[model samples]
Target: MKYKWKPVLAAMLASFCLFSSPLTALATDNTVSTIEDEMVHNTEGAAEAGSAETQTGESETPVQADEEPGWPSGPSIVAESGIVMEVSTGTILYSKNMHAQYYPASITKIMTALLAMENCELDEQVTVPHEAVYMEDKGSHIALDEGEVLSVEDCLYGMMLASANDAAYALAIHIGGTIEKFAEMMNERARELGCEDSNFVNPHGLPDERHVSSAYDMALITREALKHEIFRTVSKTVYYEIQPTDKQPDLIPMSNHHKMICSGKYHYDGVFAGKTGYTVVAKNTLVTCAARNDMELICVTMKTEGRQVYVDTATLFDFCFDNFKKVDIGSSGTEGEEIEVSVKEGDSPEKTEKIPFRISEDGYVVLPSQAEFSDLKPLLLLNADRGPEVTGAVLEYLLGTRTVGQAVIALPESMIVKPEPETVQNETESEPEQEKEKEGKGFRWWYIPLGILGALAAAGAGFLIVRRQIWKYRWRKNRKRRRSGRH
Candidate 1:
């Protein structure tokens, strides 16, 4: 009977556990998930509130294992030296032997144009120097006669549009006083622009052993040049007409050698402009641009084995647009539930303002869904003032992550921010006065008490010392007297 009852009791307890266990598990799971979501929300709040802009790569998630590379043609274009970079962010999307040194050939003109545009005034008159009219017997030439006068602007069009060595030489002399000096300036500018493995023997990229540049360095130069509006307008010119001069009266008809400039085969629309170059040694160097769906890509290929430079550039552009996209990092266009940050204001008595950030509008380079923001850091560009009508504050922002391209954070325009009534504002006009009053009261009350206590302690210590001395003196006198009596 006892064994049978034991079995019955065990069975009853098992049935009870089975009935209650599911409910208990469901509640625990829900609570854990809520806590997790709350944590994620708080962290993301820092990110959305623009405070996270101060944070760096540590807070970002790891990229997926099977994530797609940024460029669509990343795997397709195989050249001795190549790179595909985002136009706005200057982020490298794809690369191969990019840092390897190779003759830049005419692409050296890109830097030449950059220097010339800033230094030589467009309206300044230039006379062809004898030294520029004649260079080492090799390389392309526009054959300018010595002492011929032309506007500095015409010479620029000639150097860039015709890829003429003579124009490049003339421009260098006009700006630097000599070709050798100009070359020094070019090398100096290269160092300033962070081109570590570059040297310029001449202003125009003729195949001098000293006139060599790495694909990476050329890309860096081009990236900087693209910042100038003149370069974009000049490099992409389909036809340029140099004014007729006394020496050569025929209006020089200049055409861009970049095949994409005229060829309808490649779909390059935003290719506002780019330079082309080639030499037997350099082997078909090409740089070009294109836009698709509002994203512009700059492709650079140097030292290729064939003359298919335009085709390769097009392929690279297509690969990037087809594969990658720009993602806004902050509150600009984030998907799912909206993330917002609440700021307490002081000067302006306005209440809390909700700022939402999204992904698309923030200008971040995003790969396919497989890719995640890896090693991301937020850059906050903020402005503040100590006076009313605060000078136009710019909340400029920037974000960088490994897998995603760098994102530009657009700042809010200058506007007054006010504090919510419920929230405490640290900007109390009476703060100093209140602190002074408290300090004065503390001195009158607790400080007086402490001072009295300290004085008593000192007096007590002095009394103990005096009592010990008196007892010692009395004991000595008594001993002396006793010794005297004994004697």
Candidate 2:
């Protein structure tokens, strides 16, 4: 009976494994398939929503989702691509497929606006070209006529507030000579702004498969754009009334599509500037900057369904603002402690000298609000090959794998002594003696002069003794000769 029970138990265990193995595999496959489906569905839904909104010229209010647990313990977001970064430190606080490239849609105007501000003055007049007004019928526009006249300032407002496609083209052509060249400039500027996965095919983000940018890249562009006063002013404007232009003579009332900035539907108190973008292919994209308690943050969300773009961005901001605090990692000179570096071939190679370095700029690290100086682990990495005279970033302070801040480890101007020209060796010295002399302790400066003086003294003494001997020989010879003469 015991043997029969053992067999039965073994048979049951085998049956369980046989059934469970396929079930486990099926569950994993379903999970992956579901994620893929969700991403595709989100993209398709965003495209439909954007198209519907553009057709109706109506902005949708964002529906807020239930708040999850605080960051690091929160539920996953629905955005296909998103990122939250510190404006000052460029430290990434939260990211989901941040580097994955997505179409930027109308957010492309940010770069166009940036180039306009840089290349044209606010008062500069620009003529709307035929190409500017000839966009697809379905695209957003402020109804600029061909050859219409507007100031650069007005164009920016029209483009940003209303996401006007014609205004963007006019500004681009005016600043960059042609749409092609303007796109080139946009790409160059994107590279300069540290955007890696981005390409600009046109000034207005219409759907070109070639025009793409990543969430991180868009954030980088937004960061640079925020630096300009005009950009900030234009982006934050809710309703800008464009004065009647020469072609139409009717005043166009433009409203910002960014509900966060215009309608204040999902507005957070600290939101200063935001840009909204949408396209059938690119889906929905958004970039916003917010500041709280002196910590500025930039958030970008892409390929989200309906109002989820706004909801996702708001959630990211909330998570970051609630959980993270800007900690002054302290500036380079604040510590007042100089780093002692062993400089090879330095003036005092035997003894290390203290290099006074200041953090290139005041650095701030974003950490959990509860994080303290004790929790921060700083590693000082010195460039062993760096010259003593070169004053630049010599050591970087890192927290874990991330570089929290960098200290410009520069040798003081006074300490940067041109290494004494290597003592050129006299070719006359033997190799062994040269090696001995190189040891520095082997010979003093007085040794050569002392040796010369010793040789001169010895020669003089020898000359004097030889002269005395010659005189003695001459005297003896004269005496012998005189005695011989007497005999």
Candidate 3:
């Protein structure tokens, strides 16, 4: 009877598993939310072509002895176009269709914010115009009204943290008088930053058939943007609030739209700043900046499918950080440590200063972990990258024909013997200011102790005088008692 019942129990157990399996699978899948839950993971474990590829998602490739110079292996990502660039040296750590143009949705605000930061001060007041107030109600905004007054800083927070399209327009109008003029400034600035694959038509990145930018160009723009202290502050902010404007009566609160920064599900360590964007036409685009292992890297991925964009960014960051290291190639700052150069400024025969030509302090090269600092080839040039401060030399560091890094041979700000000030005011006005500074700090090292001793001496003299007076008063009282003869 027991043997006969065993098969029956087994059949029931199998039935239970069959019914519950779908429920279990559904629960596990729900952890991935919103766009990611809808994303088709077709490109998982595959690299979109034309990249020096590695397996996606935390998979690492060891540096090979025979790998090409200055190129490290990067991960397979679903982004249609992407690149990983070291922020300091501007070295291309990873590449995949990097220069290919695509519509760059709201990531366009990076340029808008950059222009605002460069052109305007934080507390500068900006007014909301009619065009900005009347944009499509469907686009992101804080419901600002026409003639609303807010500072440039408030507009920046709204644009960056809330992805507000209206703020971008207002900022555009404030800086360039109109969006059209502002976009021209954007393109001009893009060109100045060496962004060859971009054209800016709008500040808010609303879909226009003519609007387009490339991943490489976006990366370059971001790299330049990060140089400003305020830009860094805006990008990394998780939450912000704007005081009610003239049009709005309530305080407005905002959370960063960049999921990698605010959402714990996709949070990555060392990812300090990022911008996220999407439109039906542009798909998902992302730019993130992270610092780890002494390397600040910018990762730009455009036309990605969904949450995989975040995954792709993290994977690339890990790959670069795990495989490469920054090798310092700066001047040792010691005698015989630098080559001597003759610098004759202004055709003045007064002095042809023999400046010790040393590599700039900012000179550092990113190389594969297997490579050594000794492997870099140094070449010296007479060109002054910085026109005025450069004592007339630029040291170019190369790794097998690739220009890995360049350093300006600069005159130190505190040259034990500095060159004369360039301007007449600087030469004349600086002397008195310097003298005043010297006078302010003049050998007052003894003043503190001397004042303390004087205070103590005064207190001691006061104490002795008081004691003498008290003793005299007591003797007088005793003498008066003796004269009375009351005892």
Candidate 4:
């Protein structure tokens, strides 16, 4: 009975294994499939995320390239309008909304000083007007009073160094007769200096909706002002001692308001001249000039908040000095050898002569430090009356579409060869004689023989006629004799 029960139990266990094995295997396969689906979904999501990141990374490639070695990514500046210009070449190195107009504040005195240097003698006396001294209630001034006398030079120092509104007004009134007239003169001079978007409503740059200038226009005005020796001298003055005026008995010591020029904290090694301007409306406007290794740069920053103006200007100067260099495109004393041009309709159409042209002046071009001469393209623009003797600008060197420098196309005074006038021989006189000679030569040798033969034939015909006449006569004579004999 025990052996029968053991066999029955073994048979029951075998049946249970047979029935559950397939179900268990199916459940395990379902679990693996669900996990694979989850893994596939996660992999697809990760790939999609990676693809988006790659697209974003590609857009930022240029900025990354600018940060690479030897490549300069310009410093971030907070100024609303700024420009860095090369003084010698007038090449703008960096710009941010440079043409947008903003209030000039005290930087207007750069033009004021320039006009004073141009129109009046430095030692000439300027009588301060009451309106000029009292024009601005809340602005920088040197405490000038009515009928106070100061030289043009002293007023320029006062205006530029101290950002004195009164000094600027007095100088303007002296030069232009009235403030409105001076404003007109300022606009005219600004146009002459290539400032297109500048308007001066007041000489002191007091806040007015009409009185505004762009960073680019102010840079142009500053560049022109720097050309004047007196302006340069007065602008760089850190401290100037003004002699006691009739209105102010105490000696008024004026110091430049520009930190880069006066204070040591923001001062730079090569900073030579600068002007500072500020108002509640026009915040922290600054114009500065610096020189390093003979390369001069002018930096103008406008609408900057707080002390960032000086930092922005100094950063611009560093960028220019680091990345750019002045290349001498042409030298003044070195004249280009004469270029030969063929004269088409002159005395000798086949003749070619040389035109000796010199470079107009020593022309410099500001370019990247790594730039080469091969990057420059020379375009020769011949004059409408272009000839060996015509003198003017012959060719211009260009970097892309910009004209970098020019060469004077002129005939040398000593080497100018006037073309000889061609003699006009009379065609009527010479042509007929040539035609007669040609006609004589055109007669053939056979024509001469034919003419002789025709003459001989005519003579032979005459002889025949004479013989016939004789024969008739003889025959008549014979007939008469015969008749007589018959009778």
- Indicate which candidate wins on lDDT: 3
Instruction: For candidate 1, give the lDDT of residue 469.
Output: 100
Pairs clashing within candidate 4: none
Q: What's each prediction's TM-score?
A: 0.58, 0.65, 0.66, 0.64
lDDT of 2 by residue, 1-487 (tens): 3467888999999999999999999986654332211221234454456545533334444323333233344335666778888887777777777889898888888888888878888999999998877764427777888888999999999888788888888898888898899899999999888889999999888878899999899888887878899888988888889787557789989877776765445666888887888765676688888889888899988876556666677778888888887766563233656655444342333445566645554556676677554444443343424654444443444444554443344456664444334423444346778777788776579999999999999999999999999999999999999999999
lDDT of 4 by residue, 167-264 (tens): 88888889999988999999999999999889998777777889999999998999988888887788788889999866779898987777787657
Off by over 4 Å in 3: 1-70, 331-357, 384-390, 410-487
Worst 10 residues of 2 by lDDT: 33-42
Better of 3 and 4 by TM-score: 3
**Using TM-score as the measure, what is the rank order of every candidate, best first?**
3, 2, 4, 1
Tens digit of per-residue lDDT, candidate 3, span 90-175:
88778788888999988899999999989999999999899888875336677788888999999989888777888999999999
Worst 10 residues of 1 by lDDT: 33-42
Residue ranges of candidate 1 with Cα displaced over 4 Å = 1-73, 264-270, 328-487
Query: What value of lDDT does candidate 2 attain over all alpha carbons?
Result: 0.73
Worst 10 residues of 4 by lDDT: 33-42
